[model samples]
Target: MPDAQLRPEPFIQQTAPAALEDLRARLRATRWPDTPEDAGWSLGTDLDYLRELVTYWAEDFDWPAQEARLARLPRFRVPLGGLGIHFVHARATAPTTPALPLVLSHGWPDSFWRYSKVVPLLTDPGAHGGDPADAFDVVVPDMPGYGYSDRPAGPPLDSVAVAGLWAELMTVLGYERFGAAGGDVGSHVSRYLGLDHPDRVVAVHRTDGGLPVFTGDPADLTQEERSWIDGAAAWGAVEGAYAAIHRTKPQTAAFGLTDSPAGLAAWIVEKLRSWSDSDGDIERSFTKDEILTNITLYWLTGTIGSSMRMYRANAAIPPAQHARRVEVPSGFSLFPGEPVLPPRAWLERTTNMVRLTEPARGGHFAAFEEPEAYAQELRDFFRPYRTGTAAD
Candidate 1:
């Protein structure tokens, strides 16, 4: 049977009254922590702040309403190569001359909701004063085992395997060739899309500067590169506690994360604080409700364990994963606040290095944090290959 005719499994929105009850109970039963007079983020999440937030999460937050809002979005589970992948495909209402197809992938600790603000911007660019011809039919898939998607059932799903599934999904939707964009784990998948299926991928763009591969000469490093390295080293010292756990003992880490909502919240929230341009507090950029919504998705789906397992799978790959050079046309918008934004020389080693822009501001969640700038950067990058002229 043709792939398109192969019907996608409908995402049956599951609402467990018991799960909601459990969340309320957990919040009510939270063992309170005492705060130190001088302690701040240097000591991690503030206890007083936690007391207030957990109180709200239990007393004031409306899980049913938020779940209903999410359920309103179009969702599906398509069978691809013996795997059932779930995705949210929100189509643009306004017509585009050619109807450019674009796949926006999200990374770890983020669901399809990461691009919640971004989907409309790209699909309806005219609203943002962008060319109608540049409008896209956006496909935002939850990485397998991350959100509404299924867990890695039979075999371990790595980056390359997921890319193949993505190509299949796009093909099913009649997009012969399309543009791709992503960051974090998604950035790796986007790069693999360009490398593994260059014929179908017109151009690859990533928010993360580049992958962390030791390709450049350490001896010939500029002052900036040295600082970059120093910054990275410092982060590993202070903020990389999660990475170490995810890499070595993911199952152990998952136990605590999966059990306690507060534990999950603190673990993920710490990364958002350290990795984002939030200035100091997570609430400065993301509301407590917004933060918990993402966390709730993980907890409800029981994916905290499976998601961490991805790091272990990546680590098991041979160290020579970057020995091969990529030949696809690529663009990058490097955000300074991301975990490891790469230098131009480093990016050139992995991608064809077509276009590179250092954004004045933004973070790992670029599309959500700065939509206008991110949308403008995307329009500028993909303008060259758009099929229809503005006159058309």
Candidate 2:
């Protein structure tokens, strides 16, 4: 049981008008940078698009309306592990059937906002044209140093630490056993939950396992596994610099990003465009408003630096920790646009693989990009495990 003193307090999303005005001033006064002609996102965030985005952010983007929308969700903050962790805890709405408690963790470059679109669908499946039995009492927490969660004053918290925090959080909410699912860094945390707390996490689901970490002889790996390993390395060589920076010198990068909203947007939006199933058209996957809403959250919270520090802490995790395979039943949905797909052989080696899926759409931020399909995948994968009520 959780400590009775550690009760959750209701939280509301409210930013002062002065802060919003200050953001507009900064956006309007952005010092534009030069980009080679015809570079068109190949070099980085497209200059033209960024300029247009900054203009919209300065003049048209409505923060109050978005804040109101976010506040409509059941949000709370609880003092756990000496930090006031913020989360959205919505009960399942099915009338007769009891809902399963499922915790959804979000990765970097996003917060709980990543799962906002799909929360309703999961918490009330019947309302979204799915079975009520599939309902989940959804809990989406902002990882330490992300979104509204408090930043660690000491060393940053890694996946393992965050998983422990999550376990305690579930206990505080009175959920003894539950399911876990996430993508990106969240996937790493979810894996740890299944590993470190296997007795409690019923099953684990993830989009991609963290970068391949094989220590055995190459001869033992299948051809597909070798290719997958090589592919991951190749992708990292070309596109993983952001992560490298996060792991090494996030503070140096943080100064500029913290002061300049445009710089922050360029740093994050580039990944959003490159990692999504947008086909060179980012707006296809996310509207300008949607993009700004996420970026604005980072700016308001002033958490970009602390969030990146998670990489630094995770980089210090020993090789033996990476080698440990999860014992809990696991599911993977390799979305089509995900940069490097973990082959079944690798997932089998790393997890107790029970399900593998190739969804027709989406990319890195699938939950936000294709909420309907993403929600349906969860509904189908966890259906068999939904054996008890939310209060059981």
Clashing pairs in 2: none
Task: Give RMSD to native, each candidate.
Answer: 3.0, 1.0
**lDDT per residue, candidate 2, 106-197, as tens digits?**
99899999999999999988898988878899999999999999999999999999999999999999888899999999999999999999
TM-score of each: 0.91, 0.98
Provide the lDDT at 374 for model 2: 93
Candidate 1, superposed: residue stretches over 4 Å from native: 1-5, 12-14, 215-230, 388-392
Candidate 1 residue 41 Cα shift, in angstroms, is 1.2
Highest TM-score model number? 2
Poorest 10 consecutive residues of model 2 by lDDT? Answer: 383-392
Task: Please give, for residues 246-342, the per-residue lDDT of candidate 1 as tens digits.
Answer: 7789889888888888888777877777778788777876787777788888888999888877776766656565555567788999876676777
